[model samples]
Target: MISFSQVTKRYPGAGGGYEALKSATLDIQPGEMVFITGHSGAGKSTLLKLMAAIERPTSGTVLVNHQNVSTLRASALPFVRRNFGLMFQDHKLLYDRSVYQNVVLPLNIIGYNAAEAGKRVRAALDKVGLLAKEKAMPVTLSGGEQQRLAIARAIVHRPSILLADEPTANLDAAYALELGELLRSFNQVGVTVVIATHDEQLQSRLQPRCIALAQGRVTQ
Candidate 1:
């Protein structure tokens, strides 16, 4: 679960600062699929970053999975982050690595044994419809397939919460729909999915619980 109480994030500037999120507050229940919509610079990415602890808030509290992210120590941050699976707008795949290796990166970082990690990697790839492409290079796959591979990497760690930021940014309409459906499938199985995107058609079609932002504040 995610909760924000008057949370604000500011980046220091030459003059003073710029507030990316201004006292925004909201709650996302466990197992809920939520969409975050806003125009450029509306703070959608900042909101997700706060939830993931990639950026600390300047004021108020950010709570995820019962831990106060605003106060989480660096030593314990990785433990907290393990509960989350984040999908970036850029797929961030290494071209030299195979799909299986890409999916196993997270597990490898956490010291998971090869045998166990392999099974989990296969299962995650299967879930994202990329099991057959395990040996394929990321550069060789289609845009949609690359995104699906990213999703697999995120979930291979078996995260409880999935955060996707502008996931459909450069994809075609049909691929965008396919990606949305793929994310929903994970939600159906109890993974809390929070997607930040500006795709109105995708939003209008699925119409999941949405949080709209304007100038860094929740306007929904």
Candidate 2:
């Protein structure tokens, strides 16, 4: 479902530039669950960004579902991004919005009808075990609940692929394990799942294909 061919990403700097990702190449097939694990500044997030087109490859190509995202025009990014859901470390939830309101943002962005949006929002929350908390404020939820809410928001659009960066960073071990299981449950139904994290315990539980990184390069 995804392939990277000798891709590199460099950032501009006063001295010249800093390479955030070095000639990294890998493949992630449809319906497969995987983990990208490495230390801080290891380019794990850059790898995900390259796949999502948030950052263009400095060289080579990145293909998602046979689409060469590396060469797509600016206006074409949203179309490609719709195929994947992103759950970042921050969750990015709106503190002012209710749980239900947060999950429905994606649908609203794509112009889904209000009637349909209502159903999807509830369904997504139910999936994340937050059905009863629909009208509750995001600030009232615990750390694990907030992460699950983010997951619901990400998947609310029914995206074919899910990308999460450090999803378990703040949670305790038990909650992290639960989050891993929840992610795998989505994969069980055929959604491609890829997560970047430093959580070895969580990775061990899922036993998914792991791609390790070091200093912006793929080490395994």
- At residue 102, give the lDDT of candidate 1: 94
Clash pairs detected, candidate 2: none
1-220: candidate 2 lDDT, tens digit per residue: 9999999899999787999889999999999998999999999999999988788898989998999988788899888898988998899999999999999999998999999999999999999999999999999999999999999999999999999999999999889888988999999999999999989898778899999999999999
Residue 167 of model 1, lDDT score: 90
RMSD of 2: 0.9
What is the alpha-carbon lDDT for the whole of candidate 1? 0.92
The whole-model lDDT of each prediction reads 0.92, 0.93
Using TM-score as the measure, the top candidate is 2
Q: What's each prediction's TM-score?
A: 0.96, 0.97
User: In each prediction, how many residue pairs overlap at the backbone (N, C-alpha, C within less than 3 A)?
Assistant: 0, 0
* Candidate 1 TM-score over all chains jointly: 0.96
**lDDT (10s digit) by residue, model 1, range 106-206:** 99989999999999999999988999999999999998899889999999998999999999998999999988888888889999999999899888877
Candidate 1 clashes: the total is 0
Q: In the order shown, what is each candidate's alpha-carbon RMSD?
A: 1.1, 0.9
